[model samples]
Target: MFGNICTLYYTRRKLIFDFLKPGNQCRQLVPEATVDVQRRQRKMTSPDDESRSFFAQTELDSLKGKKAKLARTGTHSHVFKATMDSRGNAQVAVKLVDLRSRGEYIERFMPRELAIIPRLDHVNIVAAYAIHRTPEYVAIVEEYASGGDLLNYIRTRPERYLQEQEAKPIFRQLMDAIIYLERLHIVHRDIKCENIFLDSNLRVKLGDFGFARELRPGVDSNTHCGSRPYAAIELLSGRTYRGNGVDIWSAGVVLYVILTSYFPFGSSKDEVPAIIKRQRSQSIHFSQRLSGEVRSLILGMLHPDPKKRLYSRRILAHPWLAETPHRT
Candidate 1:
């Protein structure tokens, strides 16, 4: 029985990849968005030219005071909300990474992120306006989401959780973004509520591609990246994992947290061992308030076996996402 299941799982995975491969019908599902993205691409210059023009023409307003610190500091970078003096004071998020910081991230992952972010042009993904690079620092100027990140947005809510109706649209938007990335063979290894942003209209804008990389079909990645709480079982267990499956697992965790305001696995990094054990057992306790379809969807995504996990196309087509939430 186990061997049969393994065979079926591998077959399903291959079918999913075939559906998502470039020039497939999956691209037709997002025709309008794809056209818009292409239009934007036409107006953009080369990354080097854009970067040089941005720095030469625009002056960034300083982020100095205590209140000026816009985002949580990472290992070697500081993020701040700033304005461009040349572009009529347009708001932007500036991520400044200090080159002097000693780490593999500074030398390797940071450059990968810089190179990838510019080529992407999805509406559901945050836009990178410019990238300023120097020996001392690397500054990434990106679109500013006025509504802030999903983590802070949920925490500040009266219920500390979103209703199924409210969460549905958000999840759909995230699915759309993920599907777009998957089509490009880009895997966003770091996907969590904190990395998901909301614009002024509360639309989802996926961001933070620091751990993102391209993973070709039939290839596997061994790097263990992303927040512990959102990491896939294969990643947490120190095994080679398909990048797409890793993303699906994290997206499941994000969905769970959006609806429950709690982690589906262990809460903190310290509980990694417990999380791994729980993942192996395929143990996930869901709230009764979530509909049967929602639970099933999450279960499909958070499956311990990466081979059996739902792919991007499957997640987007799930029945739970097709239902319309009746607005109050």
Candidate 2:
């Protein structure tokens, strides 16, 4: 079993979800008000211009004092709403993660998380623009979504099951992002409804790398981490396993949740552990609303055995996903 040394961090984690969808990259990083153009302004000579480094921590501290919007609080971090001047683009939402309260053990994993965040540039994953480290707090600056998270997105919908038209594009983009991260040897240890974000244009962007890691080649992470309901059998059972399969399993759980607004496994906290216990013998009860193609993909992804779980190649080739057009 994974040790309890880092359990405090796990309890403190207040994971959130997202809403909205778009095909275009979700990275318009300007703030709502006119940002003082003088603070580390990078000349935007062309559309292909590289991003300029963000303002110094001193400037951020000053900006954070004014109109500070506290967006979220998880176990070890607080997300503040802030903005940076990005040339003349519309002022976009920026998220500042305050990582002062996390356990030392969790903090040790942060550098790895921060290292992976900025290296990612995907339409379905949140983009990190800068990092600020102060003795009081370490913060990462990232793209902010105007829309809510996945849980709220599903909850606010008119009905329980989102139409295939709605779920497909978002899931497809998420799959693309995951594939990209896997290629970079990175794994988002935590994949759940709350970690998925959405932009004003309704585009999906995956976020929250506090539990993410970059794996060494052929290495399986020993750290068992992720939300209970969405966790794979291996992580729930406290066994070492391949990160990609674990992620895909969690993603499959998310697919089930969004489709049904209910968990296919255990529904309550006390039942969560039992879900994994039964993962070996009990067959999943699929929603009648699910088509055979999507159901097959979900079953492949949620396979109890890590080695048999779906990978990007098989997932991309799945008939349903392959033929499903992103009409949204």
Candidate 3:
């Protein structure tokens, strides 16, 4: 019963700024020592025709005005895409926040997302290039994966499921990324097909860091923010829990969906809770497509009790992940 997922894209080309052409380039601040985005943004406080035109010219022009479908909407933030330079091919994404109202939420989300995303450097994790803070909106520029997302791939498959050969390597990469995040004490609270992107090589690139959080010693989260169908029981129960457990639970759902093109509990949104309730009390019904080993792994990960859930390292060791040697 999880809600729909959203995605965005951008790309990199050893970014080099040419401030001499200020008219051609929007403000950006790149870090010297690390990937943390540093940018010189122009803050505007008025909506005069000149202001509107200035923003219109600068905002749209910076992104090369190639807007893809907006991935998400907030009280103040709206995600969009555009070319970063004249290359037309060199793209960067931006999330424009209407700072006049509902800016507080963005203020909170921006810093935390910025803090965690840049620190991660993994083949499976998406890369962030720069952050532009303007008075009107805070735009985050990042890599663009033209291969779209995993959901589309799953949906296009026959019966909305991948063959074991197709699912193996993708699942392994996702597992590797999740395990890497777990080791760093970083939890990707949301893990679903939609949050997973594919590169030209079909390599998994985990995106969307808005719900990500770092767990300090003895700390856990109870924010209750996640897609419903893939949500962990602990999260749905409104109890504080480790980020790793929730992620593991979500990953199990992803694995099932990858192998079958639909949720194990059922696809109807309204019936998901009831199905999950039954699943918690009983066990999942296996489809003909799933192998016995695959079913077992899913059961262990989807265990109702977080304490009993199979986490990253164990999942990595699962036989299904080794059934074939692939890109993972």
Best by lDDT: 1
Which is the winner by TM-score between candidate 1 and candidate 2?
1
Q: 1 or 2, which is superior by lDDT?
A: 1
Question: What is the TM-score of each predicted model, taking all chains together?
Answer: 0.77, 0.76, 0.77
- Please write out the lDDT profile of model 3 over residues 56-172, one tens digit for every residue: 225544344433445545444565555444554565555665555554456666567767876777778877765655555556656667677899888877677788777888888
Cα lDDT of model 1 by residue, 152-217, tens digit? 999998999999888998988888888889898999999999999999898889998999998988
Report, for every candidate in turn, its global Cα lDDT versus the true structure.
0.71, 0.65, 0.67
The sequence of per-residue lDDT tens digits that candidate 2 reaches over residues 149-211 is 888888888895587768888788778878888999788978888989888887888998877
TM-score of 3: 0.77
The better candidate by lDDT, 1 or 3, is 1
Report the number of backbone clashes for model 3.
Answer: 14
Per-candidate Cα RMSD to the true structure, in Å, reads 15.0, 12.5, 8.6
Q: After superposition, how far is residue 284 of candidate 1 from its true place, in Å?
A: 1.3
lDDT of 1 at 9: 14
